[model samples]
Target: MENTHGYIPSALLAGGIAGTSVDVALFPLDTVKTRLQSAQGFWKAGGFHGIYSGLGSAALGSAPTAALFFLTYESVKHFAGSETHWSPVVHMCAASSGEVGACLIRVPVEVVKQRAQANRYMSSLQVLKNTVAAEGFSGLYRGYISTVIREIPFSFIQFPVWEYLKKTWSEYQKSEVEPWQSSVCGAIAGCTAAGITTPLDVAKTRIMLAEKDSLLSRGSIRYALTVVHKEKGVRGFFSGILPRMMWISIGGAIFLGVYDKVKKTVSKYYLKKHDHIT
Candidate 1:
């Protein structure tokens, strides 16, 4: 097995590919999720095209966000690894760190995307211009805290489960060559995490797309929660859970499957180079 403690360009490359793949593939579902979670109902939010309103920006941002996240995640995990392997704590921390870094890019994309999903923007560029004009640069990061609250617990749960599944599969099969196994692991991990964090996600969407005078306007997390509950009852907390879960389950599988494939390819390329040297 290749040592997991070394700097590997392939890890960075694979992560970018994985991140972009999932985000793009899942962007439509993500739009649907954001729309359902919005204060505005679906018809007011427009039809099929509205669901993909900010895809241009989403596609543009996906690669870099994914790249940064994977690069940070892989590097941190490797550096934190012991002679043998990383402990569970190391995996969690690395995932969190990677996510935090990726969030820098993700938040802006989300702001634009969610606004579009809510029918708040005529176009992505208009979203940026208007946000800047009204709320300044900071407006683009409307749901920063809520996003972190949602994402951290998600990574904490998702990565550990994913890692455990990968290890189990490898140990039983005596090989790590199974990309489909990684996909299944990813799907399970993502579904569990997405379900748990649905409330936080709802709040984040509300905060980001809320109008100045609306009940869902930018406010405290508790206020947002109370507002959603008051309006939609307990079911409000899970408005977008359906599309979100589908997006996450399939997206996770695709993301991990691609990452594993690229990592394996990179490992083989280096191994071949080393053999030639010897």
Candidate 2:
């Protein structure tokens, strides 16, 4: 195998492909999750479709975010051109870059998704129109500040933990590990990160899902926190922690496992082909 550190591109491409697949496959769960986070009272009225209503917009938004995340991370790695075994600092930087790129693309779509998830009656287009009318072009980005705040730390933990776990696991395996192993590692990483960031995640969800006309206002992250704290108390901030952790872990496992395997396969093939040409 041609051992060069240009593998970041391969990693990014693989991550994007894997992430998009995971997002689509688990979107129904995500819809439910958002609803759970954004719920106003004890009543959980929505059915499966109600919960998953905004999946279409999510799909559209997630694909690019996933792609951009990996692309940005890879570009950063290439620019840095470091050969040292990936350190926590390096992984943190890479993850931060990846997440920031993804979140920038994802925030508006996330707002749409949350609206669809929160209200069963609202169609994706309906929500989009309502948001535009109520809040204008800027309204679509309601929870962006919270999203960025949550995602930066979330990515910092998620990527490094995932890389470290996978590398550690790979080292333990005497022979080449299967994709399943990678999946397991990914799941662990996802769960760990989700647990750490659940409060912020809830805050972001509330900010996006809040009613536009309300005095509290939908755009203010502080307002969202204030509302949740007033209504639900500190425990409320962790409302969807269980489901979120489960879903994230499973999704992470599948995403990372597939991504790592695909990238490895592609890099191997590319290297072999290059040698043949040489």
The lDDT values for all models are 0.81, 0.78
Q: Tell me which residue pairs clash in candidate 1.
A: none
Colliding pairs, model 2: none
On TM-score, the leading prediction is 1
Worst 10 residues of 1 by lDDT: 1-10
Candidate 1 residue spans exceeding 4 A from truth: 4-7, 82-86, 212-219, 274-278
Across 1-278, the per-residue lDDT of candidate 1 in tens digits comes to 44453236777778778877888788888887877887777667864665678887788888788788878877887777722455678878988998898899999988887786677447888887888898889888777877877788899998888988888788898986488889999999999988998998888888888875565556467889998899999999999899998999999899988988887778678777777888
Assess candidate 2 and give its lDDT. Answer: 0.78
Model 1, residue 138: distance off in Å is 1.0
